[model samples]
Target: MNQPARVLRMSYLVASLAGVGFFVLSVAWLGVWPARRLAEDAKRTGPGHVVALTPSEARGRVIYAREGCAYCHTQQVRFTQADIARFGAPTLAWETRADTPHMMGTRRIGPDLARAGGTRSEDWHLTHLYAPRSVVPASVMPPYRHLFAGGSDAPRQEARDLVAYLETLGRARELAGDEGEARAATVSHTHMEGLTPSPVLNPHPARPRRTGEVPALPANGDRARGEWLYARNCAACHGSTLEGNGPGAGGLTPRPTNLAEHTYTDGRLAQALWNGVSGTAMPAWRDLPLADLGALVEYVRDPRITSQLRHDRTRPAQGELAFGQRVYEANCAQCHGAQGAGDGWAARALAVAPTNFRVQRLWGTAAMRILQTGIEGTMMASWRSRLSGEEMQAVAEYIVQLYRDEQDLRAREGRR
Candidate 1:
């Protein structure tokens, strides 16, 4: 070969060798680093730390692995503002240290499952698994009812196990003792970018006349009546205490709302009872007697009853104005205009425009009805399927309160 050609070949050979060296170094370092770090974390966190799983929970893990749940659900959390904002904090490195086969799953066919534990009560999950559309009207998830033998005991056991496994997630922070203050602080300061004022807060909030005060029961609104009604009509899903812990909670998406955290007025409560929140698991109680429905509403709204069930009635940040502004900003700003007007980015894309909350009637007679129906004639969809009856009521009340406050502010300004 000529000298120039030989030199060129020599240089090419050197460069190729250097490239090989770099690849080898990378492979070795990358392979070892994560394994070593994971080991160290495991050592610090310990393994075989029992998480109080029932036999069903253990079985459910087998099913979860067998079904390739990892394909669609990732147990790990990513560190992103949107993710943290939407699904709480990112996964901690040491939290999964004890996992024999780490559940840092791949894909996101559904929301992340890292924080599934206690995020919802058990019954919600069961209903979801049986029929995804029954609970989340918009879900594309397939039903898993075939896993059970047409409502036999076998599926129930498997469901319990799955729930047990899910319940173990998100307990890491609680285990670490940072849950109380950290969670509370996060909730307190978390700002939602765009939400509209609720109509319930209007000074001239539409006050629908009550059909009647719930008459005192012949047996003084017997607890037995509530219990019987709960077991026969409600317990299959909402647990004994209306805490959303019934047998059906496991399979649901967004899950059932815990009823113990809500307070509702008689009128608002009556509306839900009379007309079920459309597009959800809560069917209309139209078939029920008005008196029975009224009693049920009272049972649900009674502070004593709620307190007995461990319900939370803490008001949102402030009076309707402040809270409604925050709610509108955080939840509505993206779809609705930034100014509580209906001009949003997706407005044109949608079949219908979001309502202008500033309008009196929009925040008046139809406010609760609209919310109950969700965004009509479009993909905005009803929240009824996702939120519980009590939650819907609370949100409705909050909206009216907001409308009232705005009107009051306007009135004060006029006087000035």
Candidate 2:
């Protein structure tokens, strides 16, 4: 209001304007100006790989923005134990350095979407997006069916573009540099521990003589025997049709493999059935009687009614459910959970979570194998010496029953 006060106010306003203008100029210099200069430089530099954006990809980017996917799924991954433990590794600055208005999302309502490309086949992505409950029953994320035409056309051109964009999120150049060295070191460490090295181990040791030796097939090879064995032993996880959609499939990570798509020779199938696939959840069936093992193998190899022959359907006489319950409560409940959801008290501390008994596909193939070898690089210790073979067998049978009960409950709930 006064002359001196007005003069001071005018001076402050000028100074504030100058500061704001300088800040804007600094940002332009560091960000927009350099990026434009770099583009011009790259053009003159010649012959650099330039990714041409497809029409669908451009549209998908628009869709991503419109849907506010950035609100839930962060593109950036921080370098931390929790991040690396859940996801694979930390993000590199150069990976997103090329991005204009970079899609480094801030919120993390879902897992980071970086490196989502090729994580699973297209079919899995389609099924997952259509109904998250169908794949991961526990996922709280909402379905995105409206994105497709009438909620159909999953695996559409747009889906492919989205997947491609996700695949391009990681620092591919940096990963290629050190992946081999890291893998080699891991293999060396595993071998040093006297455990079977992973399948990726190169220049693998010579196959021992016992590797090729398979026991003889069962006499009077009954298809009925195989069916009964499967129902009692294998049906919990592999599903009744061996499609790998057993009632328990929903809870496991890395999910169950659909056996129908798998290609293996009769011998290889037999080997998998008998010895199990190393470095995975599959377990070796070394303890099953030689004839019973052969019968089960034949049944799985040729799962047709014509393969059926009569065999005993009798349950093991010594396996009382009451006794098995006692054993589970005493020894298994701490890690597998009281309800067998695989989230025991100790599960949170583990890098790879414990197995959910509700999913049979995880425990399919050889229950005995899991009891024999346990999981590798984790605390799932072998229980062969801790429990008697009969007790182990009883526990396996109980697990199968538990899977069936869960399936029945789910079906009943669905009807409601």
Candidate 3:
């Protein structure tokens, strides 16, 4: 039997009220709740205080967005093994709270930059910005010529502002230091609850260089292979002919080292290649094969090829060695070690290990220059204000004499 159907319908006022309630619930669930969660997370894990961007940094960020820098580079480090291996820990919920729209892009045409701060010096960033291909031969990024006054050396204000902003990327997290890192690690996730940072404990490899000794370099590397590698990797800042007068040298004060002017020990080359020269534009090349590094050592140490960046190799008198030792003990020993072994009391505290003079020797002219100007990035400061030029020469000579094998070094230098 077909019963008479009756339609049950709410009155207009009741229907309107129910629909409005549902809409409100949806908004609270989808929008307001997540925002509140993020705010609380920010308070917990963020660097103890909020830092507003400076005017320059703000402007740079605008430019960064306008230029679509975010399109290729991602700011977020996800909680995946590969991401952590390449880009440090996963980006915390609090890290980007200050970001207006967020620069966390999805694509990875370039490496993540959430922690790019202090990893590279300003010069490297500027050089990379002005002409990507100049420093990195395989870069696909287009040149930002408009940001420069002319060449890379002549960066406009906009360029500087952009770099300034980049420098602030991970500053807060790093400054929060160990306390903040601990806070971030406590974040509970389905996959990462109470676990450690990554599959490997190594830091990001885009690198300011690892401090301490480099591993043993390969012996008898092919010089031809090294020369080819140098042409590609080293010839830009260091001239094609090794003259230290590459087109980019105009921008760097204290300038790219004239590798050809001075002789280097095998150990010295190993340190420079492995750890990079501290406080200078020289960066680590540990990414290269050990064989490649050894080959480079061969070409660089070859006397015939050196002297392209000729400075007077005239050395101080042998009599200065005793005086030099005195100066070194009195003033240089605390950091360079009493015997120039780079194991001084303060050496471990420094970001870059002091040069191991036990194995590496700086020649006369080069040593004199390093004394007057100082190595900008390392603990080595210019002694010009404290020591007389003669005293500096004495100390420099003392360090040179500390070379592990004096006869081998003399033979390499072609001295009797």
CA shift at 75, candidate 2, in angstroms? Answer: 0.6
RMSD, each candidate, Å? 20.7, 20.2, 5.1
- The regions of model 1 sitting more than 4 angstroms off are 1-24, 37-55, 152-154, 179-416
Per-residue CA lDDT of candidate 2, range 95-173, in tens?
A: 4556666677998877787655434434345555656655444677877776455432335566566645554544342
Highest lDDT: give the candidate number: 3
Residues 298-390, candidate 3, lDDT per residue (tens digit)? 777764665544554456576777788889989988888987888889888886567778776665478788889887656788889999988
Q: Could you tell me which 10 consecutive residues in candidate 3 have the lowest summed lDDT?
A: 1-10
- Which stretch of 10 consecutive residues in model 2 shows the poorest summed lDDT? 201-210
In model 2, state the lDDT of residue 363. 31
Candidate number with greatest TM-score: 3
Candidate 2, 42: how far from true, in Å? 13
Candidate 1 lDDT: 0.54
| Local distance difference test, each candidate | 0.54, 0.56, 0.77
lDDT of 3: 0.77
Candidate 3 Cα errors over 4 Å, as ranges: 1-4, 7-37, 193-196, 199-202, 289-291, 298-304, 307-320, 323-338, 341-356, 363-365, 368-399, 405-416
In candidate 1, position 31 carries an lDDT of 84
Clashing pairs in 3: 279-377, 324-394
Poorly placed runs, candidate 2 (over 4 Å): 1-52, 149-155, 171-243, 246-416
